[model samples]
Target: MIALTSPLLWYTARASGIVSLLLLTAVMALGVMTATRVGGRPMPRFAVAEVHRRIALMTMIFLVLHILTTVLDTYVHIGLLAALIPFTSAYKTVWVAFGSVAFDLLLAVTIASLLKQRISHAAWRAIHWLSYVSFPIAIIHVLMIGTDTRFPWMLLLVAGCVGTLFLAIAWRLWAHPRPDGALTAVPRRKGRPGTTATASTQHAPRGRKIASSGQTRKPR
Candidate 1:
């Protein structure tokens, strides 16, 4: 339990908010990179995915603490319901609504992710994209509601998070576009391996015709 008059509570809340933003940024960046299968020797695709998941869990923790501290602070009129319900806060109602919106979206994304194994992949994926909404709303909340936004360092931080995510999304779209006539996987027979040709292969060379005797018949 944090003391209402303690400056430590205020500082902790601010720090947690900043950390949550950074973690959210990392989660989003790595998510894009993972979806695009971006990786190198030092880090593989699986590693990127693993890091993204762990960071998401951590982001949730910090976010909880941030909300707790905000509710605990006597300096603000923000209440518990305000955190859970949008536009209920008496202080900075509009800007705080952004946080509320982002929080709800992130909560949905997290819950859907936890039940991913039980749910259809398409459903999980559809809800998981709410993180995209969560990120921008969080960024906007921080920018408009945060006391540090006037500082150059904070501005740079905001710019960096936005710029990096924007570039990553652009790169992902450019690298993995599904334009018409895009090259798709070479379809394999239903029961056949999709890899190298095998003895029971069905596909043959364009001009070749195999006879029942396993001999190439003349192209008459």
Candidate 2:
């Protein structure tokens, strides 16, 4: 346990926590962009979605590192239980609880996304919305408990992240309004036989036939 008291661990915990927040903010922004189908001719929609997925993966990696380092750092004596359970940490109870809750929500959303193919779209979507709740709580957690937040540069970083996320959300809600007032995947256009060919055959007179070429001809 004494080995865990290294100053390196403390710095790693702080740096990883901050990076995780930044990555999570990017993920949220990209999610909003994907929902609104923001990328067009220059950047395809699929590319935006792919970027969102990759960034989300990176966010999870950094978050896990943050959690692990924080818990292992002997300076604070934060147990694994306190890391996972809300309102149980001896140090900064309320702020730690907020972090715990946000972690739980993000974990659920990640699991739901992984199993998205097996779950109902409604179920996946509902779980996914938890991200919105988790993010603000996470910001609160950082503001209340983070030691580095006192720095002006850190404050500006947080502000910029918050501003970017809000701008994306506002653009999504106002510029891309949907009938249900929810962000959803754009419906895909299904390919089908030529409209004119299908129409000509379906509406052919009783004595006429639709040739293979889709032209009307007298019955043989």
Candidate 3:
């Protein structure tokens, strides 16, 4: 009974870690979807953007907790520094680096956004675009680091992320469809000769008016 319970607990922890990662990836994707203008449509509502931002921050918080718990459980030998740095992990250096890269990208984007007012809008906007890169890196990181990657449920999670992102891209492309109305020369109206005739000549008086005084009034 003790042996069985120990394995079950370990499995639960492993499952929780993957779940946390998946949620974080989803939060990142939501942020991207909200930031980008879809199909020539205006930006998402301020409320929507704010909600996404808050959710993303929460996701990050949960991710940190997840990492901490996983490390504490002792099932894996991941160190504190290893969690922050890429390619230093004992598990899989290259695949693990993907998570680190994603973390750096996410950090850049979050910092720039938080200091948007301090930085030039153009520069901030440029940095914010890194969110796109962050999202994909996050997905890759989860797929590689997750212990339950082979499970049917894990496969579904991966599919959902990829599918949603692809759909977003497709929608953006199809909705904005190239500017067909642009670059076409407008047809000029043809002008007729003598088109600017004088208005006074066109409205010439037919006859002159004359006034007559029928009687003279005495002055008071």
Scored by TM-score, the top model is 2
- Which residue segments of model 2 deviate by more than 4 Å? 1-3, 177-220
Worst 10 residues of 1 by lDDT: 179-188
Write model 2 residue lDDT over 29-101, tens digit each, in one string: 9888777666655666678888998999899899889999999988887889999999999988899999999
Ranking by lDDT: 2, 1, 3
Tens digits of per-residue lDDT, candidate 1, 50-142, equal 899999999999999999998898788788999879999999999999999998999999999999999999999999998998888999899
Q: Give the better candidate number (1 or 2) by lDDT.
A: 2
Clashing pairs in 1: none
Could you tell me which 10 consecutive residues in candidate 2 have the lowest summed lDDT?
179-188
What TM-score does structure 3 among the candidates reach?
0.65
How far off is model 2, as Cα RMSD? 8.0
Number of the predicted model whose lDDT against the real structure is largest: 2
Model 1 accuracy (lDDT, Cα)? 0.81
lDDT of 2 at 155: 91
Candidates in order, TM-scores: namely 0.78, 0.79, 0.65
Q: How accurate is candidate 2 locally (lDDT)?
A: 0.82
TM-score of 2: 0.79
Question: What's the best-to-worst order under TM-score?
Answer: 2, 1, 3
